[model samples]
Target: MKDGEGHISIYIELMDTSSLPTGWTVTALVNLFVFDQIRDKYYTVPAQYSFTTDYSLVRFSAVKLEWGITSFVELEVFNDSSNGYLVGDDCVFGADVFLIKQPINKVNVLWMKLYPKGNGKVAGNNISAYLCLDNLTLPSDTNIFVKFSIGVRNVVKSTIIKSTSTGKHHFDYLSPSVGRLHIYPNGNKMKDGEGHISIYIELMDTSSLPIGWTVTALVNLFVFDQIRGKYFTVPDYSAVRFSAVNLEWGITRFVELKVFNDSSNGYLVGDECVFGAEVFIIKQPINKVNVLSLSGEGANHLTRTHIWKIRSFSSLSLDFYESVKFTCGDFKWWIKLYPKGNGEGKGNSISAFLHLDECNLPSDTKVFVKFSIGVQNVVRSDIINSRAEHHFEDLSLGRGFRKLISLNKFEDLKNEILVDDVCIIQADVSIVGIVTTK
Candidate 1:
C-alpha cells in the first residue's frame, strides 16, 4: 500500500485469483510522464490484474483486505433461485440477505372436475391422492419451493367400449368388411366416485411422524411477471434456478420490487421493475430434523402395461409397438423407463432403450436428440384401474424434441382420467414430408 502518491486508481481484480470478464488479467503498472507547464507533471494509471485460474466453473470468491474488519464489503454466494433477491425493504445486519438456488421435488398426478355427487348437488371432484413433499420445512424466509403435480385420488376403473373396430371388416352388401367389433361379453365394467383426496400431512419429515406437529394444507398463487415477460407460474420443488416458483414452496404469494406511485393494492402493470419473486413457508421450531426421500417410488410415477389389443385396466408395460414408428422425412426419438425391480423400489433415474422404426425413415435422415421418457407397454391392470399419465415435453423439435401436451390436464378437464390403458402418444410419421424449418 502506498500513501504518498498524488493520485490513486480503483480496481477490484487481482492477478492471483482467477481470470474474469476483463482486467481480470495483467499486473499493476502505469507510466508516469512529465511535461513542463512551469513545473507541470502528468502520469497515466494503467492498472492491471490477473487471475490464478479460469472462472468457467465458479460463482465467486473474495479475499478481505485485513484492516481490523470494521467497515468492509465482502463477496457473497447464494443459490441461483435468487435471480436477484428483489431487495426493497430492509432492517438488516444480514437479515435482508436471501439465498436461492434451483428446485427439485416430487409431484403426484391427479385430475379433478366439478361434478354432481349424491342428491344431484354440484360438488368439488373427489381427488384421489398419495402425495408428499421432501424438505417441506423452511429454514428461513429465503429458501422455499413448490412442486406442481396431480394425484389420481379415488379413481375407479370404468368398463365401457364402443366396438373400437379394426383388422378384417365386412360390408354386408358386398363382403367388403368394415372391421370387427368383438366385445368381451363379461369384460365390460365401471366403478363410481371414491371420495375427495386427503393425503397425510406431517410437519417433520422423519422415520415417524412427530407427536402433534401438523402441516396444514397450503398453496401459493401468482399473477404475472411483466419484467420476465412470462405469465405462467410453474411451481418449483427445488431451490435450483430452473423451477418456476424458484422452489419457494414457502406457500407465499409472489412479489416483485417497485416504488409505489399509487396504492400497492391498486398497482397496475408496468408499475415496477421485477427483480424476482419471493415464496415462503414457515416451520414450527423443532430441535433435530431429518429430511427423508419419499418412502416409496418417486412421486407422480405412472404405472405401465403391455398388450395392444386388450383394452386392459392400468397394467405395467403396455406394448405400443404397433402405434410407434418413424415416417419419411421425420426425425424423432421416443424413450421409456420403468422401475428395474419392484414398482416401489428406489434406484437410479435412468431411461430405457430407444427403439426406432428404421424401415419408415427417409433414407439417410438422422434422429434429433431429446429428453423424454415413457411407459413402454401399459395396459389396464386388475390392481391400478388406470395408467399414469406418460410425461413428455418438446424442446424445439429440430433437435428431436416433441411438444408436451399436459395430457393429465386434458383428462381431468374432459373427465376421462379413469379410462383403461389408453395410448397417450400417436406420432403421425406420414406428415414428415410437410415439416418446414424457419
Candidate 2:
C-alpha cells in the first residue's frame, strides 16, 4: 500500500502447507530483510516469528523507498535448534530475490575456408582460391564492415614473408615464392565457383567516439609469394565511409583476387604454405583504440626450476616418470620428466615435456607460449637447453624436447648434469600472447 506522502508498505505471504506428508510439520523461526541497491547491502527488517502455522497475509509498513530508483529485497528463515520441532534431520528453506532486470548482448562468430580452384598448382603463378564464409546468420537489414587478410602461419617465427600497408616484402631471407596467390570471397574479376563467404566489418559508433569526432576507413590487400617469401600488392585500394549512422548498419562487401606467378622476381617458396590476416579500424589520426593488456605484450617471459633427488635413480629397475606443477603467466603448467629416454631415445637419453593444465582454461581458446626445456648441471654451472616457440590452441595441450639429455652423459660425474643422486630440470616459459575467441 502506498500513501501520498511517498511512503509505501510491502507484504509477503507464507502459503499454508498443511497438506504435506501426514506427519510432516514445519516449525521454524523466520526473519525478514530488505536490500539497499544504492548502498550495495542488506538491511534486516524488524520482524521475526516462530512459524508453527502458516498464514495468508504478512504485511510490512513504513518502508522508505526511492520513487524511481531500483531496489532489492530478501527473505531469510532460521531453525530454532533448541525446539524439538526442527530436529531429527529436518530441512530448512529460504529465498533470495532481486528487483530490477538488466539487458544482455550476444556475440556472433564466423569461420571460413579457402580452396584453390585453378589448376590446383600454384607454380608459375596461375593459382587462385575462393575463400568463403561457410555458415553465418544475421538479422535482416544488417550490414557488416570487415578487413580481411591472408598470410603464412607463424610468420613472426619464420620471417619468410612480411606483410605491411605497402605490400609483401622479403627480408633477410630470399623467400622463394613457389607461387603468389590471392583470396576472394566473391569476385567478378575472377571466376571461382568453388565457394562464397559473406564478409562484413564491425565499427563502433563514432557519435560516442571519444569527443564525438568522426572517422573513416581505408582498405587494402597484400598477396603472399610462397617460395620467395615476399608479398605482392593487389590492385584496388579503396576508401569506405564510416559514421555514427553506420554503427548499427555497417558496410557489406565481397573480395576476390587473381595471383600471377613471379618466379622471375625471385618469389617462390613451394607448393604449400599457411596464411592469415587482420582487419580493424583505421589507426592513424585516432592513435589506435584503447586496449588493456593484462600482461606485457610481445614477450612476457618467466622461468621455473625443479630439482629431483632420486637416491635410487642409479638402481631403478625400469624407466622412472616424474612431474612438477607450477604457474607462469597466470596459467597452470606442468613439467613431465622421464629418466629413461622415450621413443627413439629409449634407454639412451632423458625426455622432458611441458604440459598445460586445462582445468582453468576456457574451451576452444588459443594460448601462445615460448619455452625451453633444459637440464641444469649439478656439478658445474651449465645447462643443456632445447628452445622452441609454439601456438597452443584447443587441440594442442603439450609439447616438449624428447631427447633432453643422454643417459650415459647424465651418469658421468665430470659432466655435472647430475651430482650425487640429484637431477635438476628447468623450464623457462614466456607467454607472448593470449587470445580468447567467441
Candidate 3:
C-alpha cells in the first residue's frame, strides 16, 4: 500500500497455502483505485488483475487523489462483477472467491425453455432448465457427497424463484460417465396469460465441497425477444455466479421485473418464446466414482417333441402309461396313453392325455396352457388326436379324452394302427398366458 499528497497507489499480492485441503485453490481479482470525493470520478488501474500463482502481484500507482484534500482508496476482489458496484448512492465492493477446480468433473447447462400450460380445466405452465456433468469423481473409501439446487428468476418481476422444489424432476444417471439433473418453476407464476415469459437459471448449494479449493460456477441465461426478433439478456442479470467451499455456498438472491404478454410489452411473438442456459464449472482434484452397468436377456420361443414306442402290446404292465418328457415354454410336459381306454370307453378305446409338470406352475398363481396329444397310425398315416385347453390353476393340471380312438380302430392291421406290434405317440405344448393372483 502506498499514499502520496495528490495521488494514491495500491499493491496487491497472493500466497498459496500448500496445506490447503484438496479441491481448494487460492486467487483473488483485485481492483485497487482512488475514488475522487470532489470530482466524483474513479481512478482505477489501466488493466484488470490476473493472479495465476501464489506469488502473483498487482500494482495501482498514482491514481489521482479524490476530494482535493481528503481521499480514500478502495480495494475490491471478485470472481464476477458484470453488474456495476454503484447502487443508488453507495459504492459496493463485492467478492466471489471460486476455490474449487474441476479438471475431471465437468458441469454444463444442457437446455432451457418456456412451456405453456392452460388454466381452468388445463394445468398451469412453466419454464424449465437442465444441468449436466460428466466424469464426476467421488472419493473412494468415503461417502463424500454434494447437494445443490438450481433456481430461476423473471427479469420482469422483482422476486427470486428458487428452483428447489420437492416435485422438481430428478433422474438417477445409470451411466458411469455422466450425471443429469433438471428443474422447473411453477408455470402459473411465470408465464403471462397471453403466453409470454422471461426467466434465467442459477445454481445454489450448501453441501460440503471437496478439500483444498473454493468452488465457483458461472451460468449464462438468455431469452428470445419477440420485438427485436433475437435473443436478449436483461442488462446486468445475464450471468449468475456462485462461490463457496464444500458445503458453505448459498444462492444469490434475485429480483424479478414484470413484462406483460401484450405487444406493448414487446416480449412475446404470437404467444411463444425461447430460453437457453449455459454453465461453467471450475475445480481441481483427482478422485473417482463408480458407474454401474446393467443388462438382461431377451425372451425366447421353443418347441420340443417326445416319442415312446410300446412293445409287447398284448402284455402291457398297466392300464395307463406316459411317454418320455419334453420341455417348452420353461415347463416340462408329456403325452399319456391308456391302451385299454378309461371311464366310459374302458376296454373299447384308447385314451390319450396331456400332462403339465406339477412343480413348474406355482400353486398360488393361475396358469393357462394349450396343448395337443395323439397316437399315430403307422401304416394309415392317420392321427388319433386329443386336444386340451384350460386354466390350470391350483386345481386342475391335466386334460385328456377317455376315448381318443376305438380299440378296434387302433388294433386294425389293415390301417397299420398297430404296426409291427409297436405303437407311437407324440404331443405339442405351448404357454399362452400367466398371471399372479394378488
Question: Which candidate's lDDT is highest?
Answer: 3
Could you tell me the TM-score of candidate 2?
A: 0.34
| Model 3 TM-score relative to the real fold | 0.31
lDDT: worst 10-residue window of model 3: 48-57
The C-alpha TM-scores of every prediction are 0.16, 0.34, 0.31
The runs of at least 3 residues in candidate 2 whose Cα sits more than 4 Å from the true structure, single-residue gaps closed, are 1-311, 317-320, 413-415
User: Which digits, one per residue and each the tens of the lDDT, describe model 3 over residues 262-332?
Assistant: 45545445754444443344332444433222122322343445667777776786978877777776667
Cα displacement (Å) at residue 25, model 3: 79
233-263: candidate 1 lDDT, tens digit per residue: 2242112111222211221122222321223
The Cα error of candidate 3 at residue 93, in Å, is 89
Worst 10 residues of 2 by lDDT: 169-178
Alpha-carbon lDDT, every model: 0.25, 0.43, 0.44
Model 1 global lDDT (CA atoms, 0 to 1): 0.25
Ranking of all predicted structures according to lDDT, beginning with the best and ending with the worst: 3, 2, 1
lDDT per residue as tens, model 2, 92-124: 223232121111322233343344443333434
Local distance difference test, candidate 3: 0.44
